[model samples]
Target chain A: DAMVIQNPRYQVTQFGKPVTLSCSQTLNHNVMYWYQQKSSQAPKLLFHYYDKDFNNEADTPDNFQSRRPNTSFCFLDIRSPGLGDAAMYLCATSRFGGEEQYFGPGTRLTVT
Target chain B: SQQGEEDPQALSIQEGENATMNCSYKTSINNLQWYRQNSGRGLVHLILIRSNEREKHSGRLRVTLDTSKKSSSLLITASRAADTASYFCATESDFGNEKLTFGTGTRLTIIP
Candidate 1:
């Protein structure tokens, strides 16, 4: 099936350490997004890439960053992991504007 | 601030019963969509209703949107145990942005 894929479904890192999560898609969508979801809360948009254009949310912390090397691959980098940052990070993709998004299984980050 | 808020934060029903979830948003939207998420997994797109459309259906799922009230409802008929999951409503704003604003989800549990 043509779907989004995320690597390392579960991740554990020490406080202040840097960690990176990866996402790839076979759907060939033009837009890819990263979201942070805490337990029992809605997924918060961190940033997204439309083709090669990167758009970050206004309230997103400086510790969060994203890179889209190509249409199929996108990466999220956390410069300094904090206890509060431990949550499920989701990746999603869509064809263009106002379209249905397909999501990956998500990566659960645990900061110790 | 979250754009969408789902009512009845949690619901439990029998396998053969019908489940209804409501979502209310605060902004003008180009479209509204419903998604399903299993425990510790990614979300699956269920249905999308455009701003010009009042109601839409896909198999056992029915979605109704009332732009005037800024609210939408999802009905799942003949629910099964396999339908136990969290349901979320997402809105694509009229701004024509590529990212979607997700609502606080409704956690539904179906007992067999």
Candidate 2:
């Protein structure tokens, strides 16, 4: 049962405060991705780490950053939380260039 | 901008009935995939259909792709109450390492 795991299924943060969401995978997949999904909207690609190389989406705001310090662990950091930033943050992993992806239980962030 | 759009934002049907969801994408895709998400949880990979493959099936799930329309459909037969969830379609472009672009999801409720 290799699985992707996300910590703190629910998070509450105050506006202008910093928050961090963590994802770890036991599948040991080569590629890890972060997506932000707002209510009834598409899950927007934030960025991904292929091994250790971090690739950010062109439209991703500068306020958002990701760190993949190791193969199985990744973190998404919001430097300054905003109300609009509240959404379900999903973590997904797959073998490089593979068509199938496995997703972790998402972290739902609530910015107050 | 959302690269994919899923039809029938929400659907409610009786258990044992067939459920179908459709997705249309804007660009050339290397592959199209379907995923399921339970309430407030992560997405579970359902199926993947390559750009060249016209149809694929797994268990009670059937996926069809039409490159001309840049569209794909997922059909689930003999669906149960457990099938009530959000289903989303994601596309991988012909670009590097197959980064996925996901669509707005379809919320399916199976009435028991």
Candidate 3:
């Protein structure tokens, strides 16, 4: 089955420490996205890559950043972890202008 | 405000019953989609309804889209315990942007 993969299903980081979450997809979709999901809230789009073009949400905090070096891989880096930044980070991929996106298992980050 | 708003933040039902979730959006959309997420897991695409299409069905899942009202609904028949999850509605805006804006979501619990 075509799948998206995320590493370090659970992550713990000290306050102000920088941490990185990684994702890879076998589906070979052209667009990759990173979302932050807190409990009882909608998954908020942090940024995405359409091929090599990086599109960040206007409200996304400066601490969040992404890198999509190639079609198969993408990474989310938290420049400084805060308690508010602790949430499940999801990675999704889809072909450009497609109806559905395939998501990975997710990385749960805990900022202490 | 979120592009889509799913009513009834939570639902509890017995197995074999049907589950219905409604989503209302604020703007014209190219398509609407449903997705499911298990606790601590990423979303899985369930079904999609394009703006031009009124309704679509797949197996036990049925989705209806009303472009005029900018609302969509998802019906899951013969629900099971395994179906307990958070269900979300996502909308692709009229401009053909690939990113899907998701709703707050409905948490469904199927008691077996």
Q: Report how closely model 3 matches the true complex, as a DockQ value.
A: 0.79
For model 2, the superposed segments whose C-alpha errors exceed 4 Å read none
lDDT of 1 by residue, B1-112 (tens): 7889998899999999999999999999999999999999999999989999999999999899999999999999999999999999999999998878999999999999
lDDT of 3 by residue, B19-103 (tens): 9999999988888999999988999999988889999999999999888788888999999999999999999999887789999
**DockQ of each model against the real complex?**
0.91, 0.74, 0.79
Q: After superposition, how far is residue B60 of candidate 3 from its true place, in Å?
A: 0.7
Clashes by residue pair, model 3? none
DockQ order of candidates, best first?
1, 3, 2
* Global lDDT of model 1: 0.95
TM-score-wise, the better of 1 and 3 is: 1
**Candidate 2 lDDT over residue span A21-90, tens digit each:** 9999999899999999888676788999889888899999999999999998999999999999999999
A4-110 per-residue lDDT for model 3 (tens digits): 99998999999999999999999888999999999978899899899999999999999998999899999999999999999999999997755589999999999
Q: Write the per-residue lDDT of candidate 2 for residues B1-112, one digit (tens) a residue.
A: 6778998899999999999999999988889999998888888999999899999999999999999999999999999999999999999888745588889889999999
Candidate 1's residue-wise lDDT over A1-112, tens digit each? 9999999899999999999999999999999999999998889999999999999999999999999999999999999999999999999999995699999999999999
Q: What are the TM-scores, per candidate, against the unseen true structure?
A: 0.99, 0.96, 0.97
